[model samples]
Target: MIDSPKPTSLKAVMETLNAQEAAKPSSGLTSKEKRARTVARLVLVQALYQMELTGTGVETVIREFSDHRFEGDLEGEKLADADEAFFGEGARAIVKEQATIDRLITDRLAAGWRIERLDTTVRAILRSGAWELKFRPDVAVEVVINEYVEIARAFYGETEARFVNGALDGIAKDTRG
Candidate 1:
């Protein structure tokens, strides 16, 4: 039997809770790889949000995830192994280019809406999804939107999922269309 790693601290609880599983049909990737990437995206959003709230740096957050959270199992459910490279790239690149990313998102938002007005979770999803659409040309735009929509739905509800879809779709259209 796989041994779930013991909880090291309250931080571990946050990490596990933040990265609850998401839903996405296969996007030409093997199941294992797909799950890993999904987990990576979820983790990146959570990590970025945490950094924003706590005023932590990317390197510190990445180190904390790599050394403490990713390897451990929470309760009976194991933390799915995520794509480390992708996680690092998403977390670092999004923050590194946040102004540009936000600009892209802001330009796409509906007339009355603003990024700052979004809930922290929604903003995190939008930023991470925007980063993938803008920079990760290796991933198809549809897949990018689908993955993030699923994550938003998982964390929130149908409305948030639709909001994410609209925002990311606009980004893809402006950038990739």
Candidate 2:
């Protein structure tokens, strides 16, 4: 399990991302690595959003994103190769097994609400949590759920945090089963 970064506030993560975004080409990281990290973050965010919005297969979305869309964002020969590789692999795996993940989430839902009807932020958090649980199980499930719940609290609110926690706990159980 990827040891979750010590519990930093969501504001810190976003600030870090923003700093990375604003970093000059001359900064410590090679432009390529910087670009890659940016791309990876973007893809991660997009995948979570898309899964909630469309419930589409992850493979299809990733293929389309990689083959066509990903290229347009880069200008020269120097592209974010590492970011592309990491993001592509991670997104593909998560999307490929999304249905199974969603099923796990559905199984854990409270009475009266279905997975489809949940708010997009809640759903996105679940997708991220499921991805971590399934693909990055080396990272403790509690860490994954907690980090995502923080993300939910940052972007949404306490209500969404409860929903995210419930969904992730359900997913962890289902993945274990």
Candidate 3:
């Protein structure tokens, strides 16, 4: 693939994702909206991580968490809605196409490492990568892979970033073809 600007810094990318969430009704987002989206992404990432670990339904986790933890603040309310749509769609799409995603990963592995044996964080990263690749085709594949790889590095470590990058690169190639 052609080289591109190193995907924006993690903070910047997360900010953009949050801005998109907050600016759903419009194209431009104010600083307040951007902050709300960042907060919302944090909550959604936690919820998605929980669901991945526990196998709970995404809606169930979202509802329970929002009702208990996010009921009061105005930003929370806005974020809850945006997070519900953004993460809900992503998690469900990952579930729906898991077989295809797994097959694609399996075909690309260097050997010994299996999708099933992946750590939760790596699995989550892979799921997010697959979701972006399949559903958000408007995003360039390199950006999708690079963004998630950065996420993996931040949340997990440099070692995990390599794994995420390799797996996603393989998945991107398979899906793009």
Total clashes for model 1? 0
TM-scores, all models, native as reference = 0.81, 0.58, 0.66
lDDT of 1: 0.76
What is the lDDT, from 0 to 100, of the residue 155 in candidate 1? 68
lDDT by residue for model 1 (1-177), tens: 112123233233333333432244444777667667767877787787788777889999889888877886434334457788899989999988999999999998878988899887789889999999889888888778877787677667678889899989999998787
Task: Tell me which residue pairs clash in candidate 3.
Answer: none
Highest lDDT model number: 1
Task: Estimate, for each residue in 1-177, the C-alpha lDDT of model 2 and write its tens digit.
Answer: 111122224435444444634653344556555545544544465565775467666676667666765665322322234366666666776667878777777777777778888766566567667877877666566556655665666566677778777777777777755
TM-score of 3: 0.66
- Candidate whose TM-score is highest: 1
- Please provide, for model 3 over 1-177, each residue's C-alpha lDDT reduced to its tens digit, 9 standing for 90 to 100: 111112224455565455444545442546564454344444444555677677788667757765664653332233343444555566666677778766776776767878778766566667777767867676567556755765676566678789888888877877786
Q: Which ten residues in a row have the lowest lDDT in candidate 1?
A: 1-10
C-alpha RMSD (angstroms) for model 2:
9.2
Clashing pairs in 1: none
lDDT of 3 at 72: 37
Point out where model 1 deviates above 4 Å.
Answer: 1-28, 74-77
The superposed Cα distance between candidate 3 and the true structure at residue 156, in angstroms, equals 2.2
